[model samples]
Target: MDFHVLELFSGIGGMHYAFRSAAVPGKVIAAMDINTNANAVYAHNFPTTSVCNNNIQSLTPEKIEKLNVNMILMSPPCQPHTRVGNRLDVDDNRSDGLQHICNLLPLCQGVQYILMENVKGFEISKAHDQFLDALRLAGYQWREFILCPTQFGIPNSRRRYYCLARKKEFCFDGGHILDDIPIEFRMGVIDGMMISNLLLPDNLIGPECYLPDKILSKRVWLMDIVTAEARKTMCFTKAYTYYSEGTGSIYCPLNKKEMDIVFAKVKELELSEESEALRLELLKSLKLRYFTPREIARLMSFPNTFEFPTETTNRQKYRFLGNSINVHVVGVLIKILCS
Candidate 1:
């Protein structure tokens, strides 16, 4: 039977892409988020589906029931649980958004499956305990794994925690017993054979961001994958960010080849007067110009056919991408769940 999914905090439908990858007869019947720009992008990309822009706190069980959703996939805000953000009081309003979902869990009477994705640090949070309690009280069976995207053949190394839960009848016998599992489950992507198997040709454009000159100059001496016996390169996040910045006007490492590439691209694009002005201002800081939203969307593994509303600003686009789930990672989880 075809499953129907309801995506909560569905920024640009990353979970939807995962469902597609599973190829299990299923559809994303509804998606909800509070950001207008994100909602706009989701709508543009998924024109036939219903996209709600209201805060999830206002949603009613009756409304959800109407969609006949069999699965719930959520990626709640990481800010409340993140180390970098304001470590607000447990009762702080910032966490209220997440609390609302926990409260709504019991109300989702018909949902047979639930999947949540979040930062690796969520395992220690009180909010996570609360979430587990609710799932347990609901008589659901669940399992969690801390997975990195590289294991699945993606070039990125974003490590995230994924929880898979099912109603009692559908749960696997060993679902909750992860302690005895082999250490392979926790292996970083660099150790995975899949990375080499799916390695794209070197010509695939590296991230468009820029990096410092010192790092760029060092690249020449670094061994190529076939010749060099290094197990792994730098972490993807830092490398991508650094490369994107280096490619732009940030600090032109005094290297002729690198400078030529950046200057040529800048001239080729002939950015708008306003963008040029912003670029100049960014140059003053010596930090590489941030990736265009389109570039970010690509890095997140959204299809080229995916559309973003023309009305959204580049900065807003970056925020949306930053908030999105890594599509390839989600796809692997969906495959496991469906299998």
Candidate 2:
């Protein structure tokens, strides 16, 4: 049987792409997000589907059930659960949307499977507790993972929390979410997966794959360095394209000796208007440049067919990608459960 999905907080339809990539016979009947940029890209990419531009809290069970959706895919906002966030958790204004979803769970009746994703700290949050309680009340069983793309051999290090829940009758544990969380979970479960196995072929890897984004300036030294043979890069957060500090890894090709000299020179100079040009010139000499939006999308496992409108800025593209999911990694999970 084909699964029908309702994607909440469906930033750019990353989960929908994963479902298609996994060869799963399903369709996302409706998707919701408040970000117009994301919704624009999503609509351009997924022309046939119904996309909602409203807040999730305004959603109701009657409206949802009418669509004949059986599965729900969500990657709720992480700001309230992130360490840099206010730590308000369920109390945060941003979390009210998810709280509304939690409130709708039991009443939706037709939903049999759900997959929710968030940052590492979310599993320990009050929001987690509240959402789990909603699942419990709705008679759903779940398996949670604190999984990284590295585990699947993808050359990026996004370790996200995924809770795959299924209705009681669909699960062997009689709908009980497992509390015995493993310290590590690997994909390619047949022979036990390795990080080296899920890599992109060499031909597909880009030319400037090792250059750090030039925008790093003096702090360019802090960019997560990696080679093509290397198996990991840092997580690309929503701020990736616009900022270099904490967003994602840059492809810096500078050697240790050159990097040391560059940083030492930066440290020796006074960090004022006079030194700014010198620092940028120094970083430029090291061949620093941000990953093009396409490369970042490739790292996230989006297929080549995916494209953004010319009107979408590089920053906007990266923002959507940063908020998106890893297609291959998520596809594996989708197949495991729905197939």
> Which candidate tops lDDT?
2
TM-score of each: 0.69, 0.81
User: Model 1: how far is 199 from its true place, Å?
Assistant: 13
318, model 1: CA deviation in Å? 1.6
Q: Which ten residues in a row have the lowest lDDT in candidate 2?
A: 174-183
Q: How many angstroms is residue 130 displaced in model 1 relative to the true structure, after the best TM-score fit?
A: 0.7
Clashing pairs in 2: 153-195, 210-251, 211-251, 211-252, 212-251, 212-252, 213-289, 213-290, 214-289
Residue-by-residue lDDT tens digits, candidate 1, 99-190: 78778778888888888997767777888888888888777877777876555545444667788787754333454423222333322122
RMSD of 1: 9.4
lDDT of 2: 0.76
